[model samples]
Target: MPSMRTRPSRIVLIALLVVAALVLVAVVAVSAPILLHRSAGGSGQEIPASAVPETTARGADGRVRTLSAHDGDGPADLGAVAPGETLRIDGSGFDAGIGIYVAVCAIPASSEEKPGPCLGGIPEGAESGTVDESRLTSAWVTNDWAWRSFATHQYSDASEGSFSVTLTMPEPASTGLDCRETRCAIATRADHTAGSDRVQDMLLPAVYE
Candidate 1:
């Protein structure tokens, strides 16, 4: 009987198998990051379908304002929201195509000489300005407040329809925050469909106010 020996063909086959395995491992490694990025999209946190993100602030006058809004409608009357309730808004604006930006903030005291984009607190050591409704001069004090604290519900399509947004505010276990006089500002960065980049803003004063 002839003694069995390793064949050249068998050796080459083994090398090919090793190379194939390495290729598969490399493919998996390369796709992992992309897979993670897609999965981690959208602020990397899970919120309820109707949940609206909000920011809180206290005015010098002792009133509290909680700000939030959706894609199209002006900011909802957050003061009217019950602890477990959802606020639905209906409206139209220039940003009907892209969506609306909503911000809820306490308008600083008139004495503070606060400015536009008063939706959030002014940043520390930042440029403080003023929003003159008379002259139409608006100033957004950076570093003092938080704007866009939550993304607007971006489901508004063309044809201009109504959109709903929900925010889960903390329970007012003894009139925690005087949502009275709280104002909601909804701004839309309009799409230049017609001519101008007309941004529209609507302020919904608190129900009590």
Candidate 2:
């Protein structure tokens, strides 16, 4: 019952509305993949001042760098570490600060691989800190993970997103045991002053120091 002029106008309006709805659906379909990617990979997490990622991670520092523990005699080879040698940690994603660390533990002499069996991950907890005390009652541990920090360079120096730090390897006496002449597992950590100082506490177990 509408006029001819208004009937044509309504038809045009309906066609425009249909086109708009189609455009909106196309936009959402195109963007759904991007949204899913961001959800799965995260939007690049911020690297806290001193806190390292929970797992072996590239973090924000850049590509994942190999963290090797050696006394300079051709890499640790994941075997018996030499005594009285300075440990050099070269890698990426290490935050800059004076509290860089190298934590060592004697792996089970049995045929277990590094970081397996009696040897667990260092900086061992939800946050970056010493291994869980309640879990390390029997494992051979160090008196202090942070012994000789020799980091003069800041992580910011790595404009290319790489960083390195070196610490003097713990001695036999440092582990509160005669582990100097044994094969060990090494884990790197940092002070992360931006985090909690309580995590920096390096003490012995079952025996107060």
Candidate 3:
């Protein structure tokens, strides 16, 4: 017959072993997803540089400007901008201080429906970058379910937040893909906050390049 004290020791040892096993399992469970995600091309990819069509934006005063791309230097190019479509933006030299919403619409000049403005709900994974005025880069993406990759590196700045310029979407994207009427926007607030505005600019998928 084993003493009760001896049995207690055995029980404790078994508990410890169980806990150790669980710890190992937990480590594997957590790390496995991250490892697999990265291997699956999580986000970073070798995007080649190509000739992107740029829409030269002229302000009401006739000042010439270039609409930024959502992802810069991606394989896809920015071609023509159409009406009622949203131009996603990415750039440096712009304020990203956005609080709650950022959504808008830009209708084509040939359409009868007036372009309506809307608020963009905050993006799912919101992050922040530098506020230096020297840096100039970032990209814009569509909120459509297709996960369509739109303009890349269309706007940016080192200051982290500054919306000095606005861009409009063109009719025909450089990719020649028929674009939809709606577009999404992401901008840096004057104080480096995040915000979205109604802009015009079109982006094509990198795969098409």
Residue-wise C-alpha lDDT for candidate 2, range 74-163, written one tens digit per residue = 553333333434445444443332233334544332221122111222333424344343332122212212321222333434433344
Stretches of candidate 2 off by over 4 Å are: 1-65, 70-73, 95-99, 103-153, 165-167, 175-184, 195-209
lDDT of 1: 0.32
Worst 10 residues of 3 by lDDT: 38-47
lDDT of 1 by residue, 102-187 (tens): 32323323322221233323222223332221211111211101222222233343333334343333232223234344432322
Better of 1 and 2 by lDDT: 2
- What overall lDDT, based on C-alpha atoms, would model 3 receive against the true structure? 0.30
RMSD of each: 18.3, 17.7, 16.0
Candidate 3 residue runs with Cα over 4 Å from true position: 1-52, 70-75, 78-106, 110-121, 125-209
Residues 1-209 of candidate 3 have per-residue lDDT tens digits of: 89888998999999999999999998776455334431111111111133243333332222233434443344213333334333444332222221112222322232222222322222222333222222212223222211212222212332332223223333323232322434322222111111112222222221111
Ordered list by lDDT, greatest first:
2, 1, 3
Model 1 scores a TM of 0.29
Instruction: Give the CA lDDT, 0 to 100, for residue 127 in model 1.
Output: 30
Ranking 1 against 3 by TM-score, winner: 1
Off by over 4 Å in 1: 1-84, 107-152, 170-198, 207-209
Error of 2 at 170 (Å): 3.1
Q: Pick the candidate with the highest lDDT.
A: 2
lDDT of residue 59 for candidate 1? 29
